[model samples]
Target: MIKEVGIIGLGNVGKVLATFLKANGMLYWAVSRSAADDENILRNISDIKELPSLIIIAVADKYISAVSEKLAHKFGKELEGVFVFHLSGALSRNELILCENNGAIIASAHPFQTFFVTGNYENVFVDVLEGISWGIDCKAEYFPEIEKFINKLLGKAKYLSSETLAKKAIYHASAVAVSNYLTAAITLAKKMANLADIEAEDFLLPIIKTTIKNNFSDVDFPITGPIARCDLAVVKEHLENLSVKPHLQKSYAFFGAALLELIKDEKIMSEEQIKQLEAILLQKHLY
Candidate 1:
């Protein structure tokens, strides 16, 4: 029953969502503290003339609570059956709990994709939202309407309970591991490749893409490398050579140890071979 949509904040996600809503001929209003400088963003209004049925607060995480409080104070007196939501991946719905007390519904929708403000707004607004997974934390009563809106945007909502919301830190950590750490890992690889007078794009990118492709499409994708082959000698040589690079050495040891567990579980290596690799990886002498 979300008839009118109001968007607050004109940052990356906000811009994209607003653009999408406008393009689709959806009735919506937007408010932002600062004026919109980006040509792609429609001019933002300071306040809504008629309160919208759905209010999407897309501000930064730190400001969500403050903004929610402000909204509850400003319009809570007349706001009824209004649904207020934010687009923060790590913040809980409890941040907008005040709205619920004011006879408003509260929820949050977190798009799993990354948004770079400088990029093409049209593409990010359209392509990125299509069939993407959204992490939704909302009151049980508000779920159906939220899910409907998410479907309209071509996204699937993964509902989370309050208990799950309490674990947002861990959930966000996993996302950071895949997104941010992947970038960091590539940076390290490029730096090491620089030592060899090699360009990462020319040398590493194809391999990276292929590995990622396999990871997604192939469940039984057999891992290839010294660890998978149980080639203890090569692993020892790597450990010894990488020792000079503390960061890479530590990363190798940690991941190598984890791979040992997978190999053991799969019965791919004999117990003696696993023990030998484990000993080399442990490097008890280092401690």
Candidate 2:
């Protein structure tokens, strides 16, 4: 039932949010500090005449507090009864305490998806919001309204307790580990593939896709590699081969150690084998 929204940033996430809201026939006023050619975007927060029912401070984490304070200074107590939130996964509703103090219903809602403004706005599908999970940390009293708003976007609302900082931090850390770290791993893989004169995409794409599919479909033990099989010899050979690129070798070792920690409890390998593999991965020369 939320009809109007105010977005205070125009970066990748902000642009996608604006596009999605506009596509869904919701009235939105987007504000950006930087000069933009778009007629719909306002260049200053002071230019906003009327505050929307829902205001999303989509700025970077470093600016969330400052922007919240700015809104409080600009609109004052007019923010009362308004739903104000940010798109930060790591930060809790505390970042908007200024607005909250002014009686705004504050929350932090992070969509569990990577966003990139690649091309035309028309090509930016609003359907990307469909079926994705949103990490929402807010007061219990405000949760139902937020849940309804997410439901409207066809996203599941995962309530993260605002009382616990560790939970929110861990939630965001897990997101970074999966999304950002996965990208880094793939980049490394592509680089290694290119070094061997193979078309990186042609060789890595299909397997990467399959591995991800298997990872989701087979949750019990989706890992498959020399590490999974406890093939220390193969791992050692890989390290030896990667020695020419010490940076890549260090990355591989770090990832291998982390992976070993992940599967250690699965009992895929004996303790002695695990120790040996750990020793190989932790060898000072790799660092």
Candidate 3:
């Protein structure tokens, strides 16, 4: 029974997670070394010695190693038998192996979802975690509580073992791709739109919204614009016009190549079409 859910960092992620946990009638405790006193009640406590059953550290990666080092001292102390966890996507469960050595069960319960302070984000976890992946690497005891917390709150948990680290890395990278790279791609597209003399960013709202809806709903089949239509003429013009953004030409070419490959794999484009797109891309010589 996770009566008290303790957080070590009180950023947007920590705050939102604590909110969800507390809303479920669980005790919320947190500690932040650099936080202001007026930030949140659960924050401001800098030491984690007293420790709760499930202690979540949402700090920077550099500090996580140090944090685990500090927790390592508590081995055979009061903090023994605690369930230690974090929210980092790239780091492994071994970074906190010291905590495990100290008799603290260690795992990572990263929500495969984005964090936003406002907007309709509470429901973002609604269907997102139906078959969504989570992570953990500890003895058998901690999993049932973690799964219970995940299932009862808003999502599901997929346990991770040492053998599944590669899949977990890929999964976390995919989440980053969806959030980080999607934003980058959209920013690039917005620059392209700006080239079309579409100045106001608000003008992109409906397009952005529809594109995201398509992404969440369509998956691999979500293709639009000239590439999906096999309009090489438009692609040629795009390559020609991309001279204004010399650094972006290679990226555009890469995306076009990937897009073509996807289309061909779907049987939407013929071999000749692929050749034409490839030749035009080669002519640009964005390499």
Candidate 4:
């Protein structure tokens, strides 16, 4: 029975949501503090006469509570029992209790995907959001409403257990490590490639694709490099070269240690070779 919808932020997620909603022929109203900067925002709350039944506070994690509180204060009496939610991966439903106290049904629906403000969203929802897993924090009773909402964007919702919510920080850290940290790692690799007068796309992208594909097929067997082969000499040479860049040096050693553990567990290297490789990683060598 969800009809009109309201989005309370116009950042990357908000903008993408607004564009998709509009394209899907859904009636939605959007507002943000910096509405002037974004064409997707309709108007601020002060200008809206009637509020929507579904309110999604797609603001940053830190500002979700404040924005929900503001909206609760402004429309608490009018929108009783309306569903209000935020799109923060790390936060729990407790953050929206203020809005719930004001008679709103508060929840969270966080899509486990990255969003960027692209001007065209014609097929972006189908391309990016479809089949994406959503971390939804709410009571069992609210899943129908939340799932229906998620269906609009073609996503699936998994109810986050209390245990998962309790460790939200750790869950979010894993996401950041793969998504944000992966991007940073790629940038660093590209910089190193430039230093060597090489194009990253020409040298790295194919191997990256192969590595990812191999990961999907056999995670335990995907690793292939000096560490996997127990080639201590090659690893030592790499460490020596990496010594010139402190950041790269640390990144390599940190992840290299983790890889060494995996290789040891798989018995890929002899005990002596493993010890040699471990010592090479721990050794101090100046560029």
Whose lDDT is higher: candidate 2's or candidate 3's? 2
The lDDT, on a scale of 0 to 1, for candidate 2 is 0.86
| 1-287 per-residue lDDT for model 3 (tens digits) | 66678877767677667656766666456677666674344433344446778778888777887888766764445557777888887787777888877777788777777665465535544444345556655556678888877776567687776677767678678888888877777777787778788863777878888878887894768878887776889988888888889767767887788777777778877788778778887664588
Better of 1 and 2 by lDDT: 2
- Cα RMSDs, all models: 3.9, 2.2, 4.1, 2.9
Top lDDT: which candidate number? 2
By summed lDDT, the worst window of 10 consecutive residues in model 1 runs over: 38-47
| Candidate of highest TM-score | 2
Residue ranges of candidate 2 with Cα displaced over 4 Å: 161-166
lDDT of each: 0.79, 0.86, 0.72, 0.79
Distance (Å) between predicted and true CA of 182, model 1? 2.3
Which pairs clash inside model 3?
A: none
Residues 1-287 of candidate 1: C-alpha lDDT, one tens digit per residue: 87668888878888788888887766477776674464433343334557778889888999999888877788776667898889888888888988878988888888888766566776665567888889998877788989998887778988986677889888778778778777767876786687667887999999899888887884664679998887888998887877777777777677788778878787777899888888988776544
> Residue-pair clashes per candidate, as listed?
0, 0, 0, 0
Give candidate 1 regions above 4 Å deviation. Answer: 34-49, 161-168, 217-222, 239-287
lDDT winner, 3 or 4: 4
Q: Write the per-residue lDDT of candidate 2 for residues 160-272, one digit (tens) a residue.
A: 75454567778788889888999989998997897778999999999999988988894877888888888889999998899888999999899999888877877677888
